[model samples]
Target: MSRPILFFVIFITLLSCDKKENSVTDVQVLFEKVDSIQINYLGSPTVHDLDPLSQRVVFMEHSLSDSGHEIFIADFDGNILSSFIKDGDTRDTYGHIMAPLAIDGENSFMAYSFNGFIHYDFDGNLISRVKIVDFFNPGGRILGMGYGMEKWEGKYFYVNRGSKNADYGDKDFFDEYHTMYLLDPSTGIRESIIPFPENSLFMKGNFFFSRAWEPVFHISESKLYIVFGLEPVIYIYENQAPFNLISSIPIELPDYHYFKGSEKYNNEDVRFFGHRVTSGKISNIKYVDNYFVLSYFPGFDAADTEMSISTNTGPDFWNAMRKKYTTRIAILDSQGKVLNDFVPEGLSETSMKVKNGELWMMGKPNGEVELDYFQLFKVGLTTKGP
Candidate 1:
């Protein structure tokens, strides 16, 4: 074949290959329920999530106070490899570790605070800071909730909301929905917005929707999945500028459609209730090759309090609430079809992560205290014969 014709043929073939859909992946997935394997580490604030590297795993370690936080890098044997962001006071290099964004475990990682974000390597070496005060929002536009962002393929996707106490131009002080933007990593400018369905707001209130609601984003390959920490919905999109919402999955959480007003709480300042109707929501999600593994809590019924001596959910509220409810998990295929559903006892999705072909999470044997152990669940996939 001539050079021009050969190149043409190769181009055509590549285009067709890109058209191949995931439905053709004959890979069948199964949860083996292999007895839980516990990491040698234990205690309150145990390893929350696992970021599996070829040689180690990295998790964000937070102390009782902000100053002692560090990016804890450890081995499966529970030996510390290296810890990053040694001192939170190093404001020039590292900011307060408000929320752990993610770490590639090799080149770069991100940590978030109320101010903005700081980037570092696995060794805690500073790469740069994405400071909003002097860098991005130099205008000091109102102080809204800062962003939680992730860097994928050299681009950044910032997720957060506007302020609830201060307004900036068109944005309301009590905005109900979370806002996402495709940000320029070099300039820290919002290039474009990623729109969510207006109906997806858990509620239209102020702090209830803004403060209590947590959202998580998982990126696998070239796809991004948006999961509400307090709702059983998954929004999937192509991971790119102006992320195209390709599909959505509703996992049917308890009272997901139920809503109420805050007047019942005797707080007129609070807005209406939607997510408050249900005490639980989807806690975490992991996107494996051809499967979507997610975990959720069914929530505790207040009526259970009437059945027990628990007159008040005081200092032991978390323990009592955990004992009061159960955790559920679901497995879905690339087609958004349910493959299998199971609720494992003592499984928490609060910091669940899919790593090295396993579902990793924080769990307790029989917790009277706080989450005390990190465990792994085996996820099995078998390719059927054609």
Candidate 2:
């Protein structure tokens, strides 16, 4: 395994289960900015997860001169408690830290890179490492690369897009392309579960859409919550061996538009299609406590995207889109019913995590402010009485 491959797989996955609330309560959701924290780092880091044990933020700062990737643990008051860099050339650094996993137990959290899973303490010391190949049966070969490793309720689940049963251009390609597996690290036993919904847009040979968008999912409370990009629907599943579908909730999004892929596009055309495309799509699906937070682009005009590319102003187009389109978040109850959906003010759509039962979001960047510190703010969600 290499760094980019692991990163892409991790990206695809960073890209949920909790309890039973069968009834949808009729209430309005409101977001209020509460407290804020700042970290004096300027590498455009991404917040991976909040460590429950230490209550510190686990984030990554990349492009650090020559160190490859660095993970940092910091307090809410902008204090960097500890940080470590994992270089592929280093002997025991797990061949470069690819992605950080949820905090494990009280002493440490887990991360995966090109080598395998690496355990590190709060002080950024390597506790142990397990190779990726060890997760399979001895002498048993896997046809495709195993990527997107997520830990849920003591077991590890990985998504493998390769299959011996189908090829890329086959009619059943998409079905085989999205196979997820459940693995027990203790026994090295793996079970295949969860495939792309048969009725998904990509299953009908819409490869362009798949190329342009990646699926976002979360497993919570022994259940799987996923929103395929370009599809404004949440698919809930029982996160067991068979991964049975529980419910499919269609989200009512305002100002949402999507591009339908044309079969005539080739590989090069797909790249161009993604660049000139303007569509409203779900960017992330996160499960927080009892509710789910969904981030989405509220649609952009194709003419505007085309003008930016044609006028040599492409560099400014993306930031303009972020300011104009503005990411909208939808709050759904445990049962996948929409409680409320609105654009949160002064919050960036980068990463949102729940801390102490409140949602924390990255502060949206204003052009006027120098990018010297990373700021996070707590957004309190309240329900209005029916």
Candidate 3:
């Protein structure tokens, strides 16, 4: 090869690599500021869930009216595109169908407990229904449903199922031992990726009912990331037992920071929330990233209650009773070092998804009870020092 040709080839290769690097870096800086807020409802509007299909966002709203809860589709800017009141009683149903609206190719599908699963075309036309029984064995139950059509190397579409249990707690309840399954919707075949464990602690506990399992599973052509939350148990004693009386013992788990637990479980920190108390138990786990984001409600009880009163306390005593306020957010890196902490305003539900160097979040404003609005926020990540 000529000397000039060699130099030209090296220059081209270097430029190509720089372009690829710049592309990734640019995505991290693509975070959009809060341009506006759109309210989907005015009076007592309840947003059951939200899902992203194509570039559109689909959500369900439950309100008080002649018609019951209905599914509504809109754009990311909160422009209502389409809606229809579900026939019959669609209210009081379990599972968050809006989150996992699976877009299989051009068609979208959502699963419900009352009616197995419903499919719709790209234009939101009703397609066929797939019964839960047809896919599972007799006496099998529907665990949970999510919608999104993701394709790997093959022609198969993947859907997830949350395992079901008759003894599972009722509405406004949570089960600690929830299992997840990955299914091939095209063939109606399913395989368990996370199986339900026997004698799950979250199943039998009564002090604090478990909440819905918000299992995060994001898949790309080459990688898959799953995020799940777990709580630790804090035991309580009936009387002044030695274990309960110990204070400031300097107990330390290798990686975790122990905090106070509830009085129900023997009033001991042995169990943090509901599971065995340990530093390793409370940390969030992200796949292959070498780092995880640990999130917890600091001042809230296991029941998610913001306030409580003592039976022995009078009106005046109520004022004297110790109250705890919940801490908002804590961002930790792979080594469990606190990196950032911020109290997000009106943030009820927080979900983070990172793609192409950008962090996308679906955050509900004004807590989950009084607000039915969601805000999508983005933040760019750069190598530059914060």
* Predicted model with the maximum lDDT: 2
Task: Point out where model 3 deviates above 4 Å.
Answer: 1-53, 64-66, 87-100, 103-109, 112-114, 122-124, 134-178, 195-228, 231-291, 299-310, 313-323, 353-358, 363-374, 382-386
**Per-residue lDDT of model 3, residues 5-46, tens digit only:** 221110111112343233221111112233222535544433
Instruction: Write the number of the candidate with greater lDDT, choosing between 2 and 3.
Output: 2
**lDDT at 303, model 2:** 74
Cα lDDT tens digits, model 1, 137-246, are: 22112111112345566666645544444332223322433455555545545553554455455444423433234556677777888875565668888886567788
lDDT rank order: 2, 1, 3
Better of 1 and 2 by lDDT: 2
Best by TM-score: 2
lDDT of 2 by residue, 133-153 (tens): 534222112110111345776
* lDDT of model 3, residue 39: 39
Error of 1 at 31 (Å): 3.1
Query: Model 2: which ten-residue window has the lowest total lDDT?
Result: 8-17
